[model samples]
Target chain A: SQTIHQWPATLVQPVGSPLSLECTVEGTSNPNLYWYRQAAGRGLQLLFYSVGIGQISSEVPQNLSASRPQDRQFILSSKKLLLSDSGFYLCAWSVLKGGGYTFGSGTRLTVV
Target chain B: TQLLEQSPQFLSIQEGENLTVYCNSSSVFSSLQWYRQEPGEGPVLLVTVVTGGEVKKLKRLTFQFGDARKDSSLHITAAQPGDTGLYLCAGADTGRRALTFGSGTRLQVQP
Candidate 1:
């Protein structure tokens, strides 16, 4: 069985601080990884997706950038965080054809 | 860009009542998926309807995909308290890797 692990369940960062959120999948190789953000009382927005290592496609350009450093590891980072960056971050993984996904426990970040 | 719109942004219903959630789109899609997200957790996929006019039943939940593959519906029979959560519908745009998700529907079944 595959399980996804996401770190820092909750965080509070000051404005202009650096941020790093990591997501990793266990028991799956070369899986498609995605990064999503869900604002309070809103839908999940796709921020980045990677089909393979070092192949990240960003959906919305902003202060955030995503990197797939390994086969099952996807990272979302920001050099200087903005107040609007505060939201619940979710990580998801899926295989080639099957559209259904398994999501990791999200990271809730609040920028002050 | 393709967009999915869900109806009934929020619903509060008593247990044992029946309810339906709809997801619609103007553009056709290859497939549509339904997911349930619990508070403080990620969304869990409930079902995926691939073929047009396909209907799949999981216990009390019945999901149907429209013939044109542009819409889908989920009907719950005698809903229970455990059925309370956020319901989301996502569609796979033709030739796109990412699924376009609807705004979502929040369902609360009070016992």
Candidate 2:
């Protein structure tokens, strides 16, 4: 069975600080990865997605960026965080053949 | 861009009651999926409907895809407190690799 792992399940960052969240999937190769953010009392908002290593697509323009450094490793980063950047960030993976997404536990970011 | 709209954005009911959530879209889809997300957790897949007018059952949950392939519904029979969560509907279009998700419906089943 495949499993997804995310680091720093919860984090508190100061405004204007840098941010980096990591996501890794085991038992799957060449899977498409996605980054999503959910604000309090709101639905998910897609931030970025990658089809392969070094290939990334931005769904919405904001303070965050995503990268696929390896076949199973994805990273979401920001040079400087904003107060609006505070939200629950999620990482998901899916096969190329329209498979349903498998999501990681998610990282709750609080930018104060 | 495809858009999915879900009705009854927030629903609260007692356990053992029945309820239904609807997802509607103007664009046709190749497949539709239902997901449930608990507080502080990512959404988990509950069911997927492919063919037009398809219906699938999982214990107390029943999912139905519209005949036009542009809408879907989730019906919970004898709901339990454990069913309290955010319900989301996502659609996969033909030749598309990504899915467009609905805004979501938050269901609160009180014991």
Candidate 3:
């Protein structure tokens, strides 16, 4: 069984503060990783996806960037936080070809 | 960019009632998926629908993929309070790796 872990479970950051959110997958190797953001009770917006280490595809160009440092470790970072950057962040992993995804518990970020 | 539209953005019904949520898209999709998300949690994949005009049933939930692979629907029979959550439909566009998610339909079943 594969699982994804994301943290911190909740975050409160001031404007212009640097941000880092980490996600890791266990029981799988070379899995495709994805970062998604969702507004309160809304649909998910794709932020970034990685096919392999050091390879990231960004969907929406905003205040966020993603990096795949290890095969199962993905990081989402921002140099400065914006009020609009606050939301629910989710990390997911899937096989190389399958469309199915297993998501992490998610992080609730509040930028004030 | 492909877009999916879900009808009845918010639905409130009593337990034992039946409801259907529809997801429509103009662009063709290679595969479609439905997910349910609870408050403050990540969405969980409920079912994946492939093959045009395919119908699949999971307990009291029925999912159908349109023949053109451009639309889908989820019907819940005799809904229960445990079924209340946010329902989302996502489609994988042809040649695309990421899925396009619908706006989502929030369902609330009162007991």
Candidate 4:
């Protein structure tokens, strides 16, 4: 069975501080990875997706960027955090060309 | 860009009641999916509707895809407290890799 893991269940950081969130998947190889952010109990906003290693597609141009360093390792980063950057971040993985996805537990970041 | 809109953004109902959530879109989709999310967790894929006019039932939950493949609905019979969560519909746009998510419907079933 495939499982996803996301780090730092919750974080509190000051404005302008650097941020890094990591996600990894096991039991699958070459899976498509995605990063999504959700507002308070609302829909998810696609941030970035990667079809393969070193390939990232950004959906919304904002203060965040994503990178897939390995086949199953994806990282979301920001050089400078904004108040608006604080939200629930979720990482998901799916088989290539498949519609359904498996998501991680998510990380809640609060920009103080 | 394709978009999906959900109705009844928030619903509070008593357990054992029946409720339905709808997801509508003007653009056609290749496939549609329904997801349920709990607080502080990720959305879990509940079902996927592919063929138009397709209906699939999972226990008390029934999902239907419109004949035109432009809309879908989820109906829960005898809703339970365990059914309380955020319901989201996502569509696979034609020729697009990423799924377009609906605004979402928050359902609360009080016991």
Best by the lDDT measure: 4
lDDT digits (tens) for residues B29-83 of candidate 1: 8899999999889999999999999999999999999999999999999999999
Q: How far is candidate 3 from the true structure (C-alpha RMSD, Å)?
A: 0.8
lDDT of 2 by residue, B1-111 (tens): 788999899999999999999999999999999999998889999998999999999999999999999999999999999999999999988766677889999999999
Can you give the TM-score per candidate against the true fold? 0.98, 0.96, 0.98, 0.98
Ranking by lDDT: 4, 3, 1, 2
Candidate 1 per-residue lDDT, tens place, A1-112, comes to: 8999998899999999999999999998999999999987567899999999999999998999999989999999999999999999999999964489899989999999
> Which regions in candidate 2 have their CA more than 4 angstroms from the true location?
none
Clash pairs (backbone) in predicted model 1: none
Show the lowest summed lDDT stretch of 10 residues, model 3 chain B: B92-101
Q: Interface root-mean-square deviation for each candidate?
A: 1.4, 1.4, 1.3, 1.1
Worst 10-residue lDDT window, candidate 4 chain B: B92-101
Global fold similarity of model 1 (TM-score): 0.98
Q: Is candidate 2 or candidate 3 better by TM-score?
A: 3
Per-residue error (Å), model 2, residue A37 = 0.8
C-alpha RMSD of each candidate structure in angstroms: 0.9, 1.2, 0.8, 0.8
lDDT of 2: 0.91
**Residues A1-112, model 3: lDDT tens digits:** 8888999999999999999999999998899999999998888999999999999999998989999999999999999999999999999988944488888989999999
